[model samples]
Target: MTMFTRNDKGQDTASPATAQPVRSDAQPAASPVAETRRPQAQPISSSSAAHGTPSVSVISKALKITGQLESTEDIQIEGEIEGDVRAVSVMVGANAKVKGTVRGDQVQLAGQVEGKIEAKKVILTRTARMSGDVVHQDITIESGAFIDGHCRPEYGKAEVKAPGLKTVVAGS
Candidate 1:
C-alpha cells in the first residue's frame, strides 16, 4: 500500500520510522540489502536534482504501488497510498489521501492522512484533515488545521506530556 512520490525534481522522500514504536533499549538491526537503481549511471540535471545532487528515479501518478516504500529523496503523494511509507521528506498533496502508517525525515500534510505519522518535523496545514497519532521532533498545527489525534514532539529533548497529563501553558 506504500507508493513513491517523485516530483519534477529528482528527489524522493518517504520516512522509514513508522514500522516500530519508540523503544528505550537497543536491539539488533537488519542486514543491508544491495539493490541497483542506476539505469545509465549518468549525471543528472541541476534543476531536477535536489541541491545540485544527482538523482536517478521516476514515479508517476498513474502507477499505484503497494507494500513498504523506502527512499532517500523528496516524494510527493498525489494519488493514494496504503501501508507503511518511509523517505527523507514527504509531501501529501491536497487531493492525495494516505492510509496506514507514514514515516519520513520531514513530512508536510496538506491532504488527508489516516493512521500514525512520524517524522523529524510535521506540518498540519489549514487544509489538512488527519485522524491518527502524530509523533515528531517538531510539529506545527495551523489555526484552521483540524487534527483528531495525539501529538508528541521528540526534538530528542524533554519528555512530551501525554493525554490526560496536566500541562500549563504560559503563566498563571
Candidate 2:
C-alpha cells in the first residue's frame, strides 16, 4: 500500500503542507505534554501563614459613624463618631469630634470628645476639647487643652477583657 490515500476521482492529491504520516498500528496521535499537565501548587511559608501585617484604619473627614468601632490594629479618626471605639491605638484629628467612649492602649486626641476615654496612655493636645471623664494609667494634657471632667488613673485597675480575647465563665 502507498503512503498517500487516493480520492474518489482516482487522483493523488497529497500536498506537503496537508500531509501527515500514517501508522500501520492505527493508534490515535498523542497530544502535547503541556496541554495535559496540571499546574503545580506553591508552598506556603511561615511568614505568609501568619497574620501578614498590622493595618491602620482611617476615618476621613467626610464620614460619620453612629455605632461601635473595634479593631486589633491602629485607627486614625478625622471625622465624627457617636459611639464607642476600641483599638490598639487611636488618634483623633484636630477637627474631628466624638460623642462616646474611646478605648485603646494609646489615645491621642486633638479634637472634641464629649464622652469618656479609657486607655493605658492618653494625650490631649493643645486643640483638644474634652467634656467627659478620662480613665488612664498615664496621661498628658497640653496647656491650651480644655477638659471638663474627672481625670482618673484607673486604667488596668479593673478586670478588663481585651478586644478579641475569649472570656470563659466558670459556673453554670
Candidate 3:
C-alpha cells in the first residue's frame, strides 16, 4: 500500500515534479545570493591611480646589488652597486656607493663612484667623490666635489686619429 493516499476529492498526492533540463545554448539563471555576492568590473581612472610618470626603481640604503642593472626608465640608488648600471637617468644619493660603470642619458652623483661615468649630462654635487674618468657631453662639478680622473667631453665621437704620419728620408 502507498504511504500517500487520495483525499475526499479522489486525487492522489505525490512529491513535486523534477525541474526541466536546461538547453545547451541557453544561459542559466543566476541565484539572488550569487548575484548579490558577485564583484563588478570597474573602469580604471588615472586620477585615482598612478599617472603617466613611469615608475622608478629604487635601491634603498639597506640593500646591495652585485650584478648589472639595466632599465628603460629612471633609477635612484641609495645603496651599494658593484656592477655596471645603464638607465635613462641615474641618481646616486648622498650616502650611496657605486664601484662600477654608470651609463645613462643623465647622471647626477652626490655620493661616491669608483668607476667610470658616461652620460650626455653629468652633475657632480658638493658631496660627490668620483675616482674614475667621466665621458660626457655636458658636465657640472660643484665646488666641494672630489674627482681623481680626467673628464673627457667625447661621447659620440670617434677616437682622435694621429696627425698625418711624418715622412722619413732614407738619407739626410
Off by over 4 Å in 2: 1-54, 159-172
| Candidate 1: residue 36 lDDT (0-100) | 18
Model 1: lDDT of residue 81: 78
Question: Tens digits of per-residue lDDT for model 3 on 12-43?
Answer: 11212212222211322333222322332224
Residue-by-residue lDDT tens digits, candidate 1, 58-132: 334555657655566667777777777666678887777788777776789888889978887899898988999
**C-alpha local distance difference test of each model:** 0.62, 0.75, 0.74
All candidates' TM-scores?
0.55, 0.63, 0.63
Question: Candidate 1: worst 10 consecutive residues by lDDT?
Answer: 28-37
Selected candidate, larger lDDT, 1 vs 2: 2
lDDT of 2 by residue, 17-103 (tens): 222223211322232112222221223544443454446778999999999888767889999999998888999999999999999
TM-score-superior candidate, 1 or 2: 2
Runs in model 3 deviating more than 4 A are 1-54, 159-172
